[model samples]
Target: MAAPMKFHSLADKIVRTRVSSTLNKDVKQFGKKHLFDGDEETCWNSDQGSPQWIILEFSESLSVSQLDIQFQGGFVGKSCWVEAVKSGEESFARIHSFFPQDINQTQVFPLPDTDSTLTSLKIVFDSSTDFFGRITIYKLDVLGAS
Candidate 1:
């Protein structure tokens, strides 16, 4: 094909990403697709539970530089782990860990060393700001290239 078109937002055309849970399937309010739709109003709200996760896979190995995320204030992934499965690796590596504050604003995480010439990228939510353990991800755009 045409080299798959170099992408800026890795989640833009997600074909193989996996999510732990979605808040409501019937209302179509909080599905995982909203995480990268480039819309601030939409989001992926995980069901009430701890340790929720989302795995974003690439068509091939690609370089990742950073992560831009927006989370709902009260329902944030407070303690989280960012992992990656590299080009030749079989197991996922714990590339980074972060603690997102409880605020409804865009948070930028520059993975300067975390390159993701990766086979897949994963985000595991170890804890949430919400008492019910919910996570609402407003945006999930990865700055990367093929």
Candidate 2:
């Protein structure tokens, strides 16, 4: 039998971020095929701002090694921050942050260690605003070590 593949956490991995105006229609449509209900829209407006935040929840613990985030640039602004947190027994804490100067720019974030496990990821604007315009994510890649 084939040996069980060992996975490693995302320590010392390089993450590349990309900028886009919309989530790839193929991915969105593909995700919907597995879901029972609800539609996923690329552009959204939150009470806080025009740029909408994308929150990701994983079914199992992921030994995150790297991350790639794509932000959509609209009329609202040109820069934003990305954060990651490990889901804990009681609460969540910040693990990684990324700031991109322009839309369509790719930023690489390196992991500090491979021992970290991540359960959730969040993307939001730098500050709380009334609205953020049309934030788009093209892809999110998580490198694992184990």
Candidate 3:
């Protein structure tokens, strides 16, 4: 059997910042404060309810084996969608989506094969009620590759 691919931390791979709120001066300023050079920004209405998202972009290609999403509170929707994109030009593809029963709790998602390369990462909100109201993520850790 092939040995497991090595994993790396995404602590330094943050390349851009995106939120679900209206793009006002505050949001733009927030982007300027968090996003890196050549990063993209966008917003989406939550079909479920009030939505929140944290999008990250890696600087280099790496083998992603696991993903750790650390947030302050829990979500209200039935499930959340995690997406990845190979390049800024490519459209985001769904990686994982699931419902959580807990609130105000930290969540961890173990990814599938996910050998695919990613330049950007996004967390989608899917809920009926705005439990958290807005998704706020403190940090994201992508495991695999340096």
lDDT of each: 0.81, 0.43, 0.55
Q: Write the per-residue lDDT of candidate 2 for residues 1-146, one digit (tens) a residue.
A: 97865554332242322223233444444331212222233323233234545555566556665554433443233345445656464355555555554454434455556366666555555432224443433334445555
lDDT of 1 by residue, 49-115 (tens): 8889999888878788778889989998888888998888998989988888788889977674653
True lDDT of residue 131, candidate 3: 47
Using lDDT as the yardstick, the better of models 2 and 3 is: 3
Rank list by TM-score = 1, 3, 2
How many clashing pairs in candidate 2?
A: 20
Best by TM-score: 1
Question: lDDT order of candidates, best first?
Answer: 1, 3, 2
| RMSD of each candidate relative to the true structure | 5.2, 9.4, 6.6
Instruction: List runs of model 1 lying over 4 Å from the truth.
Output: 1-7, 112-116
Q: Residues 1-146, candidate 3, lDDT per residue (tens digit)?
A: 97866676665666556555533345444432432222223222222235556566677754466665444344344467788886434778888885644454445567766656777777666553444464433335667644
Model 1 local distance difference test score: 0.81
On lDDT, the stronger of 1 and 3 is: 1
